[model samples]
Each structure stands twice: as structure tokens, then as C-alpha cells.
Target: MGPRVARCAILASAALFLYSCTFFEASVVPPGFAIVYGVSDYYPASPPISGDSYDLTYPDDDAIDMAALLVEQGFDVILRTNEDATMTQLELDFAEIGSRIEANGGSDTRFVFYFAGHGYGDGMDSVYGSSFPDAWDSYFDSESGASEPTGSGAFTEQLLLHDAMPINSISVQSVDDVLAVLDESLSDDELSDLLGTLPSSMQMVVIDACHSGGFRGSGTAADTIPESYEGWDEGVSVLDTLDAITLYLDYGSGLLDVGASDVGERQAIVISASGEQEFLYEGPVYGNGIFTHYLLQTPAEADRNFDGLVTANEAYAYARDQIVRVENEFFFGEGKFVPRVSGGAVDFVLFEAR
Candidate 1:
């Protein structure tokens, strides 16, 4: 939508399953380039809390599969899974893509960025003995709130990279800094000129993780979960939950600012796995984040009209419905997750049906 500068922290709990960002409307751009990443393991080699393993079962698989899918769609892809999906490597890959795009006559480049792994929104404090990276000390304060211990509730949501620790992960600001690096490399005039010729440049980002919706910013009252729900166990506070939880569909507050645009169209679409207050699961049934499992099925299972082509909206509706249905059947309507998509009228085509 627009640009957002502040954010609030989300209250999250360690879940038994996995935890785990959108596009153009109607018009399908030819396959261009993609950056795919997933992490099934992390640093420190242990869970910050008991029973909370840094190791996940399906994220790496998700990344590899998603990359393969993009490849089938005719996209040039840069894939990084597990240990290779580090922040350092991501930056390098992203920069390389930018350089390559600039060298290739500055044409419009469509980018598909897929990340499946962990997302942390519970602020940057380690309640346990785990030590987080010091770089995050400025943005998250566990005692105060958001940026300051006594400050207002304003903290950036993060997409936990492979090396991410309890209080250390990649934030909106971190992404923005990366974009800024690219922006600084080009003169403002040159960037403006490039935008004039490349109006179709856009990015589609899909994320599967817990509290992933925070990337979309705060939501309305409709996004709040009632305290009466039974899923709030495992040592989470009802009051804190009520205060921190929100659907967060404000695309302005998302990673759009960090897209390939930097100062161009800002046409970035985000698809997130769950609401800010909800937790999503990964089970042996799918061996993928529930949303991703269904998402990968879109070409076949989500083609509701049997059109032989899947649009962004179709994939979202398909995955969202399946997630609700599966979770309802398992939790008996007690625990369910709502998937979210945010961008500007982004109903573009994802792929041809199988």
C-alpha cells in the first residue's frame, strides 16, 4: 500500500508443530528471476526453551521444492537451503541479482522470493540463557516494549534467517538497509531514469512461519482472537495475547519497501502463512507447513475453475480453505490459522495447471 515506519511486537508461544509473505492483478509477467530460501536448522544447535527445537522438518524441503516449481515455470532461480540461507549469503545473492538486472539494459524484472522457516515477533529479549546478536538490541527491548523497554509498542517483525537466534533475526529495517545499500550505489537520477523505463518490475514474496502476518503490519479489530479460545496454553498470557495480537494487513508496513524497487514502483506482494496471533503447524501428513503444502498443490488442487492456470487469488483461497478445513478437522474448530495476502490488487497468475 504505502510505507510504514513503526511496528508493535506480537506475543507468540512455542508450538508442537512448525510455525512459519504477494502481486499483480490478472496480468502474468513472463518468468524472470527468483530467490528462494528455507531453513530447517539454526545456530546454537539447541532450542532456546525445552521442547522447542531450532530444527524443523520441512523448511529446507519447502525451499528446494519451491525453487523447482519456479524453475518449471521458466524462472532463473537462486536457491539457498538450510545452512546456506544465512543473512550474509542472502545479501550477496540479492546484490548479485540487482547488479545483473542493472547490467542487462535495466529492463523490468519480476522477482519471486520464497522463504519457509521461522518468523519471530516476540521482541528481542532472551528469557532464557541463549544470547542473541547485539545488532538487534536497538530495535527490540523485552522489558519496555518495542524499541524501548518503557517505550510504546513498536517493534519490527522479523523473518528469521538460517543463523537467527532467539533475539537475533532479520527485521524490516534490516531488509530496508539492504535495499538502501542498493539505492546508494545508484545515483538518485539514475534510479529515477531506470524507473521510467521499467514500470513492470515487481516482487512476489511468500513466507511460511509463525506470526508471519506481522510483516503486513497491524490489523483491525476483526483480526483479534477472543481469549475464550482453547489454543492459548503452553505458558502464554491472555492479557498479553490480547494486547499484542492483530491481523496486521497493512501492506504499507511490510517488506515492500525492501523490494527490487527501492525507489521505483514499490510493487511488492506478500503472502504470509498465518495471522499475527495465530500459530500454524507442520505434520507428517504434508511434510510441509500446512499453507505451503496446499500452496504447492494450487496448480492441481486450487484450480477451482479448472482453468489450467492458477492465479494468486486462487492459490490463496485454495490454501486458506485447506488450512481451515484441516485444522478444524484436527482441532475441532478450537485451533485454526487464517492465511493473509497483502499487496495492490495483486491477482496475477502463479502457474499453469498440471
Candidate 2:
């Protein structure tokens, strides 16, 4: 079946309040173009991080396999791995693809961007009680009207490249510090510029790394949280609690707000392997990032309705369920690896089996 459009209206509310009520249009089986990147190597090529066990074992594999899966689904795919997966190359590719799509008059192209590598951010979610003690004091205390800060630090998430390196030399730094250095290689403004090249309004961005959800942005669904909620813990200050909840939902919601994009009728979905304040893990048993391992299973198991098509949401759901279940079983229910998706109101088919 050729691509078809679908309309969706959703009114979603949290236990405390309605975060969003949106009406959006979705598409199915649209003509697809994708760029997939995976980095299993890092800076200091002499000894090689991969050789030192600091490099990932399966991200390169993830990129190759994901590209294969997209090709099978009939998407025009570009795969970048290891040395080729650099910010400069990505910029060139983005510009080239954007030109091609623009040449077509910005048709309803389904654009997909996937990255499997080191990502920046603290992945500190207070809503779920996860926190970075150092950053917590400096980051949130300022808003909470606390006295002179004990810690002076902040955190945000960003995609990393192959040549990423440390920004500072802290004998013992937090996990967030490591992710941050890699992220500093690519600024958010630069990323936005790169994305601006793509003329398509319909897009799907998938990130598999620590704090991947931060890419979803925080202005949309996150602004829906109410200013007043009586459920605050007695021991916590209101500002502290609200800040935690807001940041968590902002980075973890997996929703992107493209309302301001110049492209008319814009709708973009972002799927992340972990929450903004979370880290992803891979093991030899799976031979891929846990999130990717399950996502690769989409073609075979994600068609929940068995309609011969697997929509983006369907694929996300299937992967998410499998991740949670498997992690719970293996970690005895202590697993916190949860994938997230953020987008406008529409969900589109990403794969078709006929």
C-alpha cells in the first residue's frame, strides 16, 4: 500500500493534571530517507579506546544493523560508523539531504535520523528519585532560594561524535561529566542548524545513549505541568520538587514540539533509549545496546495489531515493553532502562510487511 495520512487527536493528562491536549496528523508508509550513525571508537586513536575497553562493543553493529533494517523497509539509507561518524560529516550529509528534499518541493517525506553512541547529560530525574548530588545542590538550589551554592554545575544533553574528548581533567568525575565532554563537541545551536537543513516536516529521530531524551526539548509538553500541586513531599521544598518533576518530564517525555518550524504542518517524533537523566547499557549477551536490541526485533514482533505494518509508536511500545521486562527479569526488578518517545499528536508507520 502506498503511504496514507491519518489524523490523531489526543488529550493526555498526568495523575496530577493534563499535560497536553493536541490534534495532529500522522502518515503511514511514506517515502523514507534515513541517516544512521554509530560510534564504537573515541579520541586518542593511538591506543584506541575500543582496545582499552572504553569504546562500545556494539554501537557500530547497531548502526549497520539499523541501516539494514531500514533498507529492508524500503528507505533510502545512509550509514556512518566509527571514523566516518563525525559532526563535520554529519553537517555535510544533512545539507546534502536537505537540498535533495528541498528540490522535491518539501514533499511529505518521512525522514529518520538514528544515532547510537555516547550522549551528554546528567540523566538526573527527581520525579523518580534519581539525582546527582553535586549538580543537584548548584542546579536546583539556585531556583530554590538556597544560600551560597555548595556545588557549581549544570547539565544538558547533546549528541556526541567519534572524536569527542574530555573538556576537563577531574581525577574523579561524575558520569554526567564524561557525557558532557563528548557533548561539548556539538552545540545545540549547531544541531538545530543541521536539522534546519531537512525540509521535510515529518521526521523521526532516534537516539540510543545516555540522556538521549534531552533531545526532545522542554518547551512543549513540559510546560503543561501545573504550578500548584498539593502532592509535594513534606520534607521537600516546593521549588525543589517542581524543578525535579518539570526537568524529568521535559527530558523524558520523548515528545518534540515542531510548532515553530518554518516547514508547514510539521510533526516530528523523537525516540530515546533512556530518559534525560538516565544511562543506557549494553552487554555481550545482546551484542547491541539494550534499546537497539529490542528495536531491531520490531520487524518480527512489533506489529502488535498484525496489520502488516509497524508504526513508530508500535515499534517504540514493543521495544519498551521488551526492555522493561528483560531488564526486570535479569536485574531482579531493579532495572531502570526505559525508552521514551516525544512528538506531536501523530504516529506513523515505519515498517510494512506484506
Candidate 3:
């Protein structure tokens, strides 16, 4: 079902003692466009394990909740979940939404692309895939003088399809023919919606509620999980899984450095649910992700400036702290999930600019 637009009114207290409530017209900000993706299950064989090693229950909830929030923000939101969250589907949705925004809006169009799902990471480049990968190829980059991965093809970053398979080279090339006009590369537009919204403008971002193995040149996600499943499938090695993470952490457009150079300005803020080397934990504590839970229901304490406008930086800091507190209470400090914020404009208006 599509996200129905409804008026969202938030009561802001002028003072604890006064108990007076000031309502915000949700429309304080112009309605924007949003396409959200969430996956509670992974394709291929999900390692038969229990507890935190198996399928999650709240990722889909997280997506729906975020969509509701976006709708409240006056966005025409499109929600995609489970098998529908394939890589190809993601690309197509962006292209279609981009076209719509291009035709009806201008550089001022606010667009948000959000995803909450499973993410695999090598120590360096993670290609957050919705589907689990069964293969990985590693090679050296002569120009960057670093080692990179080639999973199923030469492209560095990729998303998994509904059957839990990555889009093959032929499919990617074919789709690029249609998507090239936006940024001349699927990776560029895939990283962020280019054809529909301008990155230089406010209210546009690629916020992912996924995990990055480590923050740039550190460890991989393997360090958090049990090593037994490292070789669950004969063809898929743990290293291959590491190479499959597609969340773009690079300063450029995409993970492979094939990204659009102009995006280096990092016009908007992209929020990650956890840090590079942390696990994105989903517990029944709230039947949803802790970071996401806080992100949606941000504690009143987040209005640090007391200015009524919750800037991007303020929201991120507040959520990250809450994630840490909740995880510590749940895992007894054995596991940690810290959210991260990338791009710039920490002062960008996230909520009402009042």
C-alpha cells in the first residue's frame, strides 16, 4: 500500500513548568518525495541459527515507521519491503521516482531514500546487499593502489535481487542505458537519487539503517558474528560476504570511486544505524530496531539547542546515544550498536525549522 498523507501535529512544550503546548502544522515544511525499502528476511539460506544470528523481525517495521514519519513530513512515500526490495527494484524505483520529481518539481524538491536491512561488509568497502551473495572476486586497483572486490562482475558495489542474487553484469549494463541520463552511471544515481532531486539542495539524503563493518579501513562484520558460519555455503566465503556490502562510505559518489565527483560536496546528511564495526541489533525490547525506534520517537532531550528545530546533527547524536544505552542494557555491554552520520550540513533542518 502507498503511504497515505496525513496531517502530523507535534506538541512542543514551551517550558516544563508552563505545560503549554505549541502545535506544528507538519506542513511547516513543504511536502517532499520518499522511497523507503526494508527487509526483515534475507534470501539464500539464512544460517540456521537463533538469537541475533537469524532473521530479524523489525527491519520491515522500521521501514514502515520511517515511511509514516516521511508521510507526516508531507512526503508522497513509496514503501518497498521483503522480496520486493531487490537491487533491480531499487534502481527502477529511483529512476521512476526521479523522473516524477524531475517533471513536477525543481532543485527545491526534497527527496529522501531510506533503507533498513541486512548489510555485509569487507573490512574496507561494504556493498550493503538486500540479498545474500554466493560469490565474490577480489582484485587490486592500479589507480587507487588498493585492493577491491569484484562480486559477480567488475562493479564494486551491488545490491541483491529478490531470489537473493545480485543483478548480473548484463542486466546492470542494460539498465544503465535507461538510467545514464541522470548521472551517466547507475552507481551514481543508485547512491543517491540524481534525476529526481538535486544533491546540493536541502532535504535530500540516502539514509540507511544498516551496519557498516568498520568505519573506513578497519575490520569487517565477521568479527561480530560467530565464525562457524564463515563458510556456510561452499561457494560463498566470509571474505566474499565482506566484499558484498554496498553502503557507500566513500567521499565520492559510490563505493567503488566510480561515484559522481560532484557528490563529494556531501550536500545532505546520510545517517547510519550503527558504526562501521558494530552490529545492528533488533530485539523485542520494542519490536523494532533500537536506533530506528529512537529515530522515529526521538526523545524530547534531542532538542539540545532548545530552538525547536532538530538539526540533523542533533538527531543523530541523540539516537546514537540511545542505541548505546539500550544495547548495553540488553547485551550487558557484550554487544554495541552506535549510529553514524556522514555527508555534511550538520545544521541542515531535519524537522520544523522554527
Give the whole-model CA lDDT for all candidates, comma-separated.
0.57, 0.63, 0.49
Better of 1 and 2 by TM-score: 2
Q: What is the Cα root-mean-square deviation between model 1 and the actual structure?
A: 15.1
* Per-residue lDDT of 324 in model 2: 65
* Runs off by more than 4 Å, candidate 1: 1-28, 44-48, 102-107, 122-139, 142-155, 167-200, 217-266, 305-307, 332-334
Highest TM-score among the candidates is held by which one? Answer: 2
Give the candidate order by descending lDDT: 2, 1, 3
Tens-digit lDDT string for candidate 2 (77-195): 88999889887788778877777776654767778888998875432434335433344333434444221111111234566787776322321145465444544355433455566
For all predictions, the C-alpha RMSD in Å is 15.1, 11.3, 14.8
- Between candidates 1 and 2, the one scoring higher on lDDT is 2
Error of 1 at 181 (Å): 21
Give the per-residue lDDT of model 3 (tens digit) for 240-328. 46543532343333555432321222444556665443455667878777777787765355778676666667777778677555555
Candidate 2 is scored at a TM of 0.67
Q: What tens digits encode model 1's per-residue C-alpha lDDT throughout 1-354? A: 122222211223222122420122254455467788888876644345444555788999888888888898877789998778876787677777666656653446566667788765444344322344434443345335333111011223456676554333332235344332222222212323333343236556677876565554222222233311333334545654544332133234543222121122234455778754456678888777778888888877777777677777688788878766666467644356677765344456677778
Best candidate (score: lDDT): 2
- Cα miss at 88, model 3 (Å)? 1.6
**TM-score-based ranking, best first?**
2, 1, 3
Residue 337 lDDT in model 1? 68
TM-score of 1: 0.62
Q: What is the lDDT of candidate 3?
A: 0.49
